[model samples]
Target chain A: MNKLRETLREAIVEAGVKDGMTISFHHHLRNGDYVLNMVLEEIAALGIHDLTVNASSIFDVHEPIIEHLKNKVVTGLEVNYMGGKVGRAITEGIMEKPVIFRSHGGRAGDMENGSSKVDVAFIAAPCADDMGNLSGKYGPSACGSMGYAFSDAMYADKVVAVTDHLEAYPLADVSIPEGYVDMVVCVDKIGEASRIVSGTTRITKDPVGLRIAYLAAQVVKHSGYLKDGFSFQTGAGGASLAVAKYVEEMMEKEHIQGSFCMGGITGYLVSMMKKGLFKTILDVQCFDMEAIESIRDNANHQEISATRYASPQAKSCAVDSLDVVILGATQVDLDFNVNVHTDSQGYIMGGSGGHCDTAAGSKLSIVVAPLIRARLPLIVDEVLCKSTPGETVDVIVTQRGIAVNPKRTELKELLVKAGLPVKEIKELKEIAEAITGVPQQVKPEGRVVAKVLYRDGVEIDTIKSVK
Target chain B: MKIVKNAVAGTLESSDIFIRVEPSEQLEIDIESVVKDQYYKAIYQAVDEVLKEFQVANGKFSINDRGALDCVIRARMETAVKRGGEC
Candidate 1:
């Protein structure tokens, strides 16, 4: 008995997609994703309306969704991150209901707890068999880890495998087994391979960014967390990437071996693992092609499910084992509340993917951002939206100074004792204000545009509409 | 105050606005922006505040905005108005 379908329409019919039902998609393909749009277009053509789309993330490539939202084809959106194009519309109060913004861990947990019930999950497999055995590590559109799709496949009532490349039966290296998937359909092209790793994944060459990175690495080294068996995670931002580089150098200089490096894995982390800096890489997603290739070939590079990666409901997740995690912030308030959800102008551009989860789970959560961006201060009295609560945040590193959370008194003392330029968070705010001047607060107008959820599924903050 | 010659301020950066002011019979503001669809009113409000502060009665102000914050927009308009009034 074959589970393969001739067309996506047939698979959609077989998956029992109906109006007002929730459908899901993962962003492993990132901006290169075609499955979400393809599936939605088909659904729209079939006269389906009021469908809620539960995607892991939405990128600029998914701008076609603006029309879908306008047409009432997709009335609700639940996501971890959103790019500015679609996000701008949401901020303009385009949808009737506010979008549900969840953290990566929160999304996985919500799916498992039945809070976010996905009726059908469309899995964009890079490689799959007739029986729906899938892997994102092969084929022309290989995207590396299928981590975010794991929960959807497991929890969704119907799972459909949409693939560009279909192999023979009983395919090896299965990321998701055949039992979970209900139907498999071959497509012409799932996504553009080049677009999968589009942004700058390299270390920053800018002096100011590098200085922040250098100081961040120093803070980590002296913070008492950088010993043998240390585990680390860093974002794909320029400064964060540079921090990873400097940390690797320090590890090599000290000859200290670490346990693991996790999060959206990059080639730099792969290089560190190769150089014996870390024993393994717990990769939930691959940031670049090198990481994709590494995960494909290297045994130390292990792909993990979203649940095992950072789900709060999980008994033991990789984030809980993390010693240090370097993250980026659009703005950080004096209380340490981070605003990754919106820009200083209250426009929705980003959201907490795993920002809150890793911060809460890790021993040291360091937020790295420049003091000023485009003539505006990065530190403010209050964040525009609280994407990650201040209590979970441990330290903030800026180009001008480093601010340790007051709760971490020992860490403050350690950094101060190490002769590091550790300053109070208020001082950092002052320094930023001095440079950019005390700007008028941007008051968002209109109704609520989105709800930012904490990793535990609590409504932490609400992003108001930008008028 | 009235504009005499064309004057421009600010760079066309991601978070900046470039304002071009020239002499006109009436206050005419033409804004071409990436964020004009969602933020035209806010941008107009920022321009109006700057114009009212400087008391510029009539000028053809062309704004090319790139998602600049209100403060930056005000500063840029202030600089351009000052320069435009000088000539």
Candidate 2:
């Protein structure tokens, strides 16, 4: 039977949406996405209230959510990450109910274990057939890898496929099968493709960023884990991508062939696979058009579900096979606990997506950041929020010096012997403080605004409202 | 040095501060910053020190900072004061 609907409103009514129910969306379209706002507006216009929006992540494009949160149309937010104006409002405690923050893996795990319930899930299919078979690789709004939507579609009581491009029945390249979807609604446009995925990402040209990348690459060179069959992951940030560039150069020079690269796949990683440096790319998300093209055409680039990407409940995940992962941090304390969840001012601007998951799973986890950002030092006595625990973090790389976790004495020895500048984490803190001076600790004295959960479903930290 | 006319210096970019000076009956410094919570007192002190160095007591010194360092704050303050007229 056909599952086409006249409009999103019709789909919502047919899906049986009610007050206090939970609705979900995926963030594959990122800042360009129009579906989240569109669906939320429709739900609000229907006079639904006290509903929770369980999104994979929230970006600046979703700033309209602030009005919904204020009007009580949406009272709860459960997300893997939050940023932009919505993040600032959350930190200011606009909603009475605290937002729930989870890692990408933790979110998938919770959905699977029946801990996080979804009443209705709206999947923004870039291309869909009349029967709701979906493909993200064909439409004008195409965003590769419908990875984050799998758990939502599989677990939600009702699933609605929202699409701007509708094809005939039995679509050949189906990313999400018709069995999981219940209704299909056609729209004029789903998102701006340019913003959903970058045409290309550039490596940092800043000298400081280049220096940190060089040292981090050197750390990998001597870590004894950089040889053949290596598996790696890195964030799409400038500094982290710079590290990948250096590592790629070294891999080419040494003729090392890595087994695979996992997690959020970027154009640079696509280039690496094309150059035969890595045999395969296990992509949970695509960061650029190049990655989207690769996933659509190349056999070696395989799209993976978030569960297989990092879920703790999974029998095995790609992160467990990672040899190294390079990450970025807003702040790292003397204990090496990272706070990617908040800024120096205690504002909630980010969250642990797969940060702690990869850090815990990888054999080598390196956090690369500047020692001082503006007038604020990167190393402090305590982080504003502990998004990732120090136990899993192995190294802190900066342009000035690198600090190895005390537990990794052997790794420290290897770096030192290799002529890499190694120093105590405290020493790095001191150096930063000497330049910026001691900034007065601004403790958030208001109520708790959000709860941060580890990939294992443990509450690692709570972010307080900014006073 | 004495207060003269309205003048401005610096920019609103990151690691920088925007400073505006206007002649007034009393010395007043107003600061708006991304790091105001932690660096408010430090920024006030820096501006006060600059005022002392210039020997100007009565002016409205308004600053909009995007986490500028001490050096940046001081330099911008000096430039604004100098551009305000004779010093």
Best by lDDT: 2
lDDT, model 2, position B44: 88
Give the Cα-based TM-score of candidate 1 against the true structure. 0.90
- Expressed as tens digits, the lDDT of each residue in A1-467 for candidate 2 is 76999999999999999999999999999999999999999999999999999999999999999999999999999999998579999999999998999999999999999999999999999999999899888899989898999999899999999999999988989889999999999999999988999767889999999999999999999999999998899988778888889999999999999999988889999999999999999988999998899999999999898999899998988889999999989999999999999998889999999999999999999999999887899999999999999999999999899999999999999999999999999999999888878989977979999999899888999999987
Query: Which pairs of residues have clashing backbones in candidate 2?
Result: none
Where does the lowest 10-residue lDDT sum fall in candidate 1 chain A? A432-441
Tell me the DockQ of each model, to 2 decimals.
0.19, 0.74
Across all models, the iRMS values in order are 6.1, 1.0
- The CA lDDT at A135 in model 1 is 99
Task: Give per-residue CA lDDT, model 1, range A283-314, as digits (tens).
Answer: 99998988999999999899999999999888
Q: TM-score of predicted model 2?
A: 0.97
lDDT of candidate model 2 versus the reference: 0.93
Model 1 residue A423 lDDT?
93
